[model samples]
Target: MQHAIHPAYGPVVFRDKAADFAFLTRSTLGSDRTVEWEDGRTYPVVDVEISSASHPFHTGTARVLDAAGRVERFEWRYGREAA
Candidate 1:
């Protein structure tokens, strides 16, 4: 653990606007935005597009691609040439 060589590690709030979720954790990243946490202290806030709360895979909202339909389209386009 070297002193004065490492970036400042402090509490930061990562906010997911889509999901309207925010969590506090230690980070070396800095932000100009700030938010008052539940502890009554202001912390640096970072906006994020997606998080586990809003991610399709995590929330089981992921759409499955139709491989059969794609195969059918490919066959319709190229199958006649081979025949």
Candidate 2:
């Protein structure tokens, strides 16, 4: 309820580089870069490295780790000593 104390909140475009995905949403984040959207409006564009679109879990391409093999290797080298 304060005046001129809050950050500007408006449309912001989030871009995912790996997945090549971009979406517009309201946010307080600001950027110097701008891009012309499909709606013929320019908004601040923010570049992101990863998101749900490109993440392995969301894409169903997550790699399963071999815990047994890692434990065997550790024991073989450390001789079961709790360090």
Candidate 3:
């Protein structure tokens, strides 16, 4: 691997604020923010909108999509006759 071209991969933290969850892992990403881990080490922290901890699929709280309603909406938007 080229030293200059390759990104610096190291330990980082991904935080889900909504669920108050966080985890440390290694990644190429970096952040100005930092947090102290349970292991008594500081790591770059990245705030995420969603993660497996708070994801609907992982938590089994996913909502069923209204497929028929979406079709109707599309038809109405395009002025197409609904069969």
- The sequence of per-residue lDDT tens digits that candidate 1 reaches over residues 1-83 is 87899999999999999999999999999999899999999999999999999999999999999999999999898784643
Clashing pairs in 3: none
Looking at model 1, which ten-residue stretch has the lowest summed lDDT?
74-83
Q: Indicate whether candidate 1 or candidate 2 has the larger TM-score.
A: 2
Q: Can you tell me which runs of candidate 3 are displaced by over 4 Å?
A: 66-83
For candidate 3, the TM-score is: 0.76
- Candidate order, lDDT descending: 1, 2, 3
lDDT for 40 (candidate 3) = 97
lDDT of 2 by residue, 1-83 (tens): 99999999999999998898999999999999998898999999999999889989999999999999999999998789666
Model 3 agreement with the true structure over 5-83: per-residue lDDT tens digits: 9889999999999999999899999999899999998999999999998999999999999999999999788888557
Pick the winner on TM-score between candidates 1 and 3: 1
The numbered model that scores best in TM-score is 2
Question: Scored by CA lDDT, what does every candidate get?
Answer: 0.95, 0.94, 0.94
**Model 2, position 35: C-alpha lDDT score:** 87
lDDT of 1: 0.95
Least lDDT summed over 10 consecutive residues: which range in candidate 3?
A: 74-83
| TM-score of candidate 1 on Cα atoms, chains taken together | 0.81
Q: What TM-score should be assigned to candidate 2?
A: 0.85
